[model samples]
Target: MAANIVFTRIDNRLVHGQVGVTWTKAVNANLLLVANDEAASDPLMQKLMSTTAESSGAGIRFFTLQHTIDIISKAADRQHIFIVVKTPQDCEKLIAGGVPIKTVNVGNMHFAQGKTEITKKVYVDADDKKALLDIAHKGVDIYIQDYPGEKKTTVDDALLSKVQ
Candidate 1:
């Protein structure tokens, strides 16, 4: 059975306070799936994220890109999953690997060298834009929304133009 994916978000700072509490509550997700290769392999990160999720009364699992694809595909329907990845690239990969993601939320992409600021919180480079565009092409609804209460900005041509 397919996992009940309640929400999917791309936030570089995965599984933080806002995500652990606000977004989890908003989506009513019982599982917080941190789909990142680095986080999945690191013991310290796992421990920290586990503590955070426990505090929010949700179960958390850190998985690599491939692991996420494999596990989520076979997940039980009762698992209300809130998937969080660090980049659109990772999100795209998961979709390609058969995660059944219908919508994606661009929560945060911090400023960095060679990346243009598309929104106050979202910065994108050429690769980032391409990944997002690919996700959009795959029929996923991609939108910029830092917090659940904030206004949602669709990843339309206008928003993509800013980075181009």
Candidate 2:
């Protein structure tokens, strides 16, 4: 049985109001999978995510990066899943592990000292760009779009705009 993955997104915030509500509803995803090592090991974070999901009427689960690949690889046929990772590197890991990702949404990445602002809501450094480019090379379309209905800006366009 193969999982029906609606979308794979990278959001530093993980399962917050926008993702727990907006993106999940946009993809009509029953399962909100978070693949992050830090969050997976944190009980408080898990509890908070669970609470948020419950309030939003969405199912949520947290998995370590490798476990996420293992579990998602064997997901049931009827599972309508939406994957969220904290970094593009995580998305690359899943994709490389054969997650069958088609489009990757760049939701939010806050500005850091070493990171360049790619968009109002997204920031990245060299490693981040490399990971995103790697995902792109695997034939996955990478776009920066905070929410579902908002205009999507392709990674190429974002980079181009940065140079212009």
The Cα error of candidate 2 at residue 62, in Å, is 0.8
Q: At residue 158, give the lDDT of candidate 1.
A: 69
Model 2 TM-score? 0.93
Clashing residue pairs found in predicted model 1? none
Model 1 lowest lDDT segment of ten = 155-164
For all predicted structures, in order, the TM-scores are: 0.96, 0.93
Give the alpha carbon lDDT tens digit for every residue of 54-126 in model 1: 8889999999999998878778888899999999999999999999899999998999999999989999999
Off by over 4 Å in 1: none
Best-performing candidate as measured by TM-score: 1
- Candidate 2 on 98-161: residue-level lDDT in tens? 7778999998989988888888999888888888888877778889998778998888634734
Q: Relative to the true structure, how large is the alpha-carbon lDDT of every model?
A: 0.92, 0.85
Model 2 steric clash pairs? none
RMSD of each: 1.0, 2.0
